[model samples]
Target chain A: GAGVSQSPSNKVTEKGKDVELRCDPISGHTALYWYRQSLGQGLEFLIYFQGNSAPDKSGLPSDRFSAERTGGSVSTLTIQRTQQEDSAVYLCASSWGRPGSPLHFGNGTRLTVT
Target chain B: GESVGLHLPTLSVQEGDNSIINCAYSNSASDYFIWYKQESGKGPQFIIDIRSNMDKRQGQRVTVLLNKTVKHLSLQIAATQPGDSAVYFCAENSGSNYKLTFGKGTLLTVNP
Candidate 1:
C-alpha cells in the first residue's frame, strides 16, 4: 500500500470481550508502531517494532495488551478481556527504520468497548 | 518518566493571522522533534520537524523552532486558515529510542 493501512475502521464490543486490530504498514517500511488515543487526549505509545528486533513493549498499559509483527511488515494488536476504559482510537504508524525518519500514520481503528 | 507537554491547551486565531503553538520536553537527550496536525476522526498528519542541531526548519506554511537549551519547541503557522483548525501535537525522539513521545496537544481554532 502507498500508506499505512488499518483494518476494521471502527469496532464496538461488550466489556470483557476480546478484540484484535490489524495494521498493514507501508511497503518497505521496517518500523511499525501502535498508539492509543483516548477521547480528547494525547497519544499514548503502546508498542514499537524495528525490523526483526525485539519489540518495545514497555509502553503497553497492561498484560491484556500485546502486539506482534510478522516478517517485519504487518502487525496486530490484541486486547484481551477488554474494559470500558479501552475505548479509544488505535493508531498505527510506519517508518523507514532509520534515524530521523518521519512516521506515516493510518486512519486508525476507533474501538468502543461498551 | 520523560514526557512532552504543551503550555496552552487551546488557542483561537483569526483567519489570516499567524498562529503559534508551544511545547516543552523534559529529556535533554532528545535529538529529533516533529509536529503533527490531527483533525476530527482522522490520524495525525505530519507538519514539520527539526533536529536538535538546528534551531529552526520550515515547511509550506509551517515552521518549527527548537530551543534545546530550554527544551522547548514551537510551531508557527503562517496566515492561519479555517481549514487549519485542528489539534497540534509535538513529539520528541532520541537516538536511543525508536518511539516518539507525544505532547498533550494544543487545539487551534481558526475563526473566520
Candidate 2:
C-alpha cells in the first residue's frame, strides 16, 4: 500500500470487553509502532517493533495492553478488559527501521469503551 | 514526565503570513528532532527534521531551527495557508534509540 493502513475506523465496545485493532504498514517498512491519543491529548507511545527482535513494550500503559507484529509486516494491538478510560484513538505507524527514517502513519482506529 | 513541550498551546495567524511554533526539550542528549503536522481525523505527517549537528534545515515552505544549547526547536512556515492549519508536534530521538519522544502538540489555526 502507498501508506500505512488500519482496520475498523471506529469501534464501540462495552466496558470490560476486549478489542483488537490491526495495522498494515507500508511495503518494506521494517519498523512498526503503536500510539494512543485520548480526547484532546497528545500521542502516547505504546509499543514498538523492529525486524524480529523483541518489541519494545516499555511504553504500554498496563498489562491489559499488548501488541504483536507478524512476519515483520502486519501488526495487532489487543486491549483486554477495556475501561471507559480506554476511549481514544489508536494510531499505527511504520518506518524503514534505519537511522534518519521517518515514520509513516495510518488514519487510526477510534475506540470508544462505553 | 514529558521531556519536550511547546510554549504555546494554540497559535492564530492570518493566511499568507508567516507562522512560528516553538518547543523546548529537557534532554541534552537528544540528537535528532522532527516536526509533524496532523489534520483533523488523520494521523501525523512528517514536516521536516533537523539533526543535532546542524542548526537548521529547510523543506519547501517549512523550516526547522534547532538550538541545542538552549534545547529549543522551532518550526517556521512561510506564507502559511488555511490548509496548513493543524496540530503540530515535536519529537526527539537520542543516538541509537529509535523510539521518539513526542511533546504535547500546539494547535495552529490559519485565518483567511
Candidate 3:
C-alpha cells in the first residue's frame, strides 16, 4: 500500500484476554510510531522505533503493553490482560527519519475490552 | 511534566470564513510543531508544521504560526468549507525527541 496499513480494523476481547495489532509501514519509512487515542481525546504516544535502535518505551502506560518491530519493517503492539480502560483506537504512523518530516498514519485498530 | 493544551474545545465557522485554532505548549525546549486534521474513524492527517527557527509556515489553504516566547501555536485555514470540518490537533517535539506531544484537540465545525 502507498500509505501505512493496520490490521484488524476492530477487535473485541474479554477483560483478561490478550490481543495483538499489526502495522505495515510505508515501503522505505525508517521511523515507526504507535499511539493510543481514547474517546474525545488527543493521541497519546506509546512507543517509537527508528532503524535498528532500541524501541523507546517511555510512553507505554503500563507493563502490560509491549511492542516490537521485526526487520524494521512490520510492527506489532500487544496488550496483555486487557482492561476496560484499554478500549481505544491504536494508531500507527511511519516517517522517513528526518528531523521534521511528516508522519503518515493508518486508519487504526479500534480495541474494545468487554 | 510537559503538556500541550488547546484554547478552545470546539469552534463553529460559516463556510468561506477563515478559521483559527490555537495551542499552548509547556515545553520551552520544543523546536518543532505540527498541525493534524482527523476525520471521524480516521487517523490524523498532517496539515502543516513550523519550527522554532521560523515563526510561520504555509501550505495549501493552511498556515501555521509559532510563538516561542509565549509558547503558543496557531493553525489558520483560509476559506473554510464543510469538507474542512474535523478535529484539529497541534503537536510538538523537542530537540532529538522522536516522539511528539499532542494537545487535547479542537473540533472545528464548518457550517454551510
Candidate 4:
C-alpha cells in the first residue's frame, strides 16, 4: 500500500461487545504503531511492532486491549467487552525505519461503543 | 502516567496571521519531539520535528522550537490560512523504543 490502510472506517457496537480493528502498513516499512484518540483529545499510544520481535505493549490501557502483528506485515487491535469510554478513533501508522524516520498514518477507524 | 500537555485548548487567528501552539512535557529523558496537524475525520499529518540536541528546526511555513530548560515545545505556523485550521499535537519520544507520549491538542482556527 502507498500508505497505512485501516479497515472498517467506522463501527458502532453495544457495550460488552468485542471489536477488532485492522491495519495494513505501507509496504517495506519495518515499524508499525497503534494509537487511540477520544473526542477532542490527543493521540494515546497503544502498541508498537518492530519486525518479529515482541511488541512494545506499554501503552495498552488495560487487559481488555490487546494487539498482534502477524508475519510482520499486518496488525490487529482487539478490545474486549467494550465500554462507553472505549469510543474513540483508532489510528495506525508505519515508518520505513525507526526513531529517525517519520511516520505515515491511516485515516483511522472510528469506534463507538454505545 | 505523566505526559505532555497543551497550554491552550483553542486559538483563533486571522487569515495570513502567524500562529503559535505550545506544549509542556514532563520527562527530561525524552529525546525527540514531533508536531502534527490533524483535520476533521482524518489522521494526524506530521509537520516538523526537533531532537533534544537542537533548539530549533524548520519546515515549509512551520517552525518547531524546543526549550529543554523549561520542558516546553512550541510550533509556529507562518501565514496561517483557513485551510490550515485544525488540531495540532505535540508528541515526545521518551524511551529507546521510541513510543510517543502525546499532549492534549490545540485547536487552531484561522478566521477569514
Error of 2 at B106 (Å): 0.7
Runs of candidate 3 exceeding 4 Å displacement:
none
Cα lDDT computed for each candidate against the true fold: 0.93, 0.91, 0.92, 0.89
DockQ of 1: 0.76
Candidate 3 lDDT: 0.92
* lDDT accuracy of residue A18 in candidate 2: 95
Q: Indicate the residue-level lDDT of A19 in model 4.
A: 97
Error of 2 at A46 (Å): 0.6
After superposing candidate 1 on the true structure, give the runs of residues whose Cα lies further than 4 Å from its correct spot.
none
- Tell me the alpha-carbon RMSD of every candidate: 1.1, 1.2, 1.2, 1.7
Residue lDDT tens for model 4, B21-83: 999998898888899899999999988988899999989999999999999999999999999
Highest-scoring model, DockQ: 1
Candidate 3 residues A19-62, lDDT tens each? 99999999999999999999999999999899746458888999
TM-score of chain A of each: 0.95, 0.95, 0.96, 0.95
The per-candidate TM-score of the B chain, in the order shown, comes to 0.98, 0.97, 0.98, 0.96
Which whole-number lDDT from 0 to 100 does residue B7 have in model 2?
A: 99
Instruction: For candidate 1, give the docking quality class from DockQ.
Output: medium
The DockQ-based order of candidates, best leading, equals 1, 3, 2, 4
Give the CAPRI rating of model 4.
medium
